[model samples]
Target: MNLQDSAIVQQFQQHCSLTEEEKVLLLELEQNPLKVNAGDIIWQENSKVDQFCTISQGWAYSFRNLGDGSRQILKVYLPGDIIGMRDFAFSNRLAGVAMIEEGIVSHFSHEHLLKIFRHSTALTAGLFAIACRQQAVLTERLIYLARRTAQQRLAHFLYEMYLRLGRIGAADEGRFRLPLSQEQLGDILGLSAVHVSRTFTAFREDGLVLRDRHRVTLPDPEALAQLAEFDGGYLNDAVPALFFDREWQSHMLAGPTARSDEQMPGKSKAASAD
Candidate 1:
């Protein structure tokens, strides 16, 4: 997929008002989107950071290596998700993000990004919104880890993925590929690997979901929602709490060139929104 045509970049434009000059600069960077394979480390924890990366296809996860030699999966980033935006402050990597499947990513220098913000209020606000959204995701995840049960945690994770996949038009009406392993799942959900497997087996037996290796099918949507206590309130596009600015919203829906209804089910689309 061409990075320039990726929905994430389009969303970024809407969120961070890109001027013609900034667009031109991004176009140059987008022309050479990087391809990465599963298991490849995109960045290492504590590594010096220079470029910001936005996921265009497939999925990635960020994690920290614990002193006990265990890795904790912190966040899963899908298409349209940008990582390391927080590191723009310190300009250094504090953790690592690795691809979970084959994917495309675009990287931009920190200096150029700062330049865009320096010259444009709209761009600055858009970037701020993106930062806020990331913070929101992180906060919600923290709450899930601290307060939710194992079953509820798993359910909530699935529901979040479902909504995100639907947004990018990459999901089957209620199902999609799960690009994670049992161990990775355990890390993200704060459960043991064995516990993750057992919980998944229970989900399968209950007929709420079906799983085979890296694929997951949500067979009963309502049941799954109830299990997760998913109100969809956390994903409200119209909610100002997610950090969308009015100007960015206006620019996105202002023209036909704005967001398009993503094609779904069996059609191959770039993984930007997931």
Candidate 2:
């Protein structure tokens, strides 16, 4: 797909419709896209922070390293997510990001972002809203790590990924490509690799999920959500109406239409806000 017509653009449009001039400004901000190989470090910890990028394809993650030299996976980035938004307030990166698979990212320099902020209230507000949502995801992950049980944590994580990937048309029928290895899953979920393996066995025995190597299928989403106590409300909150087009309200509940054949099954054809 054309870079401008990609899922990230559709996601931005859903947040706030751009005027013709604003759209042109966005086009100008799109630098030549970067191709990232699997396991490549896209952003290094403590690096100078001068630009951000959108995940035009594939998956990546942010992680921090402790004094003990152990790594903690912070958050996962899917297609359409704006990477590095969390560092906008800082002069240097707080965490490093690495690609989980070969992917493309579109860069926007800090100067270009400032230009949009000064000239387009609607676009600025939309970007701010997206940043807020990203923060919410972090907060929820912290909560899950601190309070949820192992089973609950894994369940919640899977359900959350389903919803997030579905928003970008990367998931369908409760099935999606999960490129993380058992070791990586353990890193993110605070489990040992053995524990991750055991948890998968338990989930399979319960018939909650079907796994075929890197592909995952949630056969009974409602049951799994119930187990996780997952509430998708945080992911679906409406952007404030003032910064959006008149049509924004209608699209708010519908979300960005799927740009690929993948879609969430067992829901309405339109992406459900709930």
Candidate 3:
């Protein structure tokens, strides 16, 4: 399968059609496959970012390392996610990005990307819209950390992940691979490691979710959204019509697999904490 076969790339094309030359350019850009192992550093803070990358498989994260030996995860990059799209205009990076598991990524030089944009209006606008959406997601995450309760934050986080995964064909109903540790979750939520552990316990006790090794399954996504006071509408683009149009809905549903109606979280009464 090609990069265009991926759901996100498909979404981009549907929103704004790419020309034949642009498609050829993208294919050339993705000619080489880059691999990074778990725990390997991809890029460091303040480094000059010369390339843009798209995750072809597995997970990675962008984070800022605090002086106190802690890291704040800013965003999780999943398959079909592009990094450096938002930061390419800037000369310096404020955070580091790394792979969370063994993964393959596609890369292109930033200057070449700029050139493509200069030549293709459709590509530029679609990319800009995607980047702006990512910025909004990050900004909302900051608001959650600053103002929401631990339980609420965790619930919102899980719901958001499920929704995103569903978009990219990674989730079936409420269940999906989490691919991050509690410590990492803590970092993302601005909580201490211990607090993350305890909050997770409480969430389970209240019948929210079950966290297994690198997997989280939600039994009741609707209830979870209610608990978190989350509205899935925010996860959509700023375009109001996109939020409710059947075409966009069909796009989200156009995946290789169908979400099971008999959905249950992987959580069981005897489930062990990872």
TM-scores, all models, native as reference: 0.81, 0.85, 0.82
Winner of 1 and 2 under lDDT: 2
What stretches of model 2 exceed 4 Å from their correct place?
1-4, 245-274
Q: Pick by TM-score: which candidate is best?
A: 2
Better of 1 and 2 by TM-score: 2
lDDT of 1 by residue, 116-169 (tens): 666655656666776776777678778878988888889888878887787777
**lDDT score, candidate 2, position 102:** 96
Q: What value does the lDDT take at residue 192 in candidate 1?
A: 92
List the candidate 1 regions with Cα displacement exceeding 4 Å: 1-4, 13-31, 239-274
Q: Score residue 19 of candidate 3 by CA lDDT.
A: 56
Cα error, candidate 3, residue 51 (Å): 1.7
Instruction: List clashing residue pairs in candidate 1.
Output: 15-126, 16-126, 79-272, 80-272
Candidate 3 per-residue lDDT over residues 185-238, each given as its tens digit: 999888888998999899889888887887787889989999888866657634
TM-score of 1: 0.81
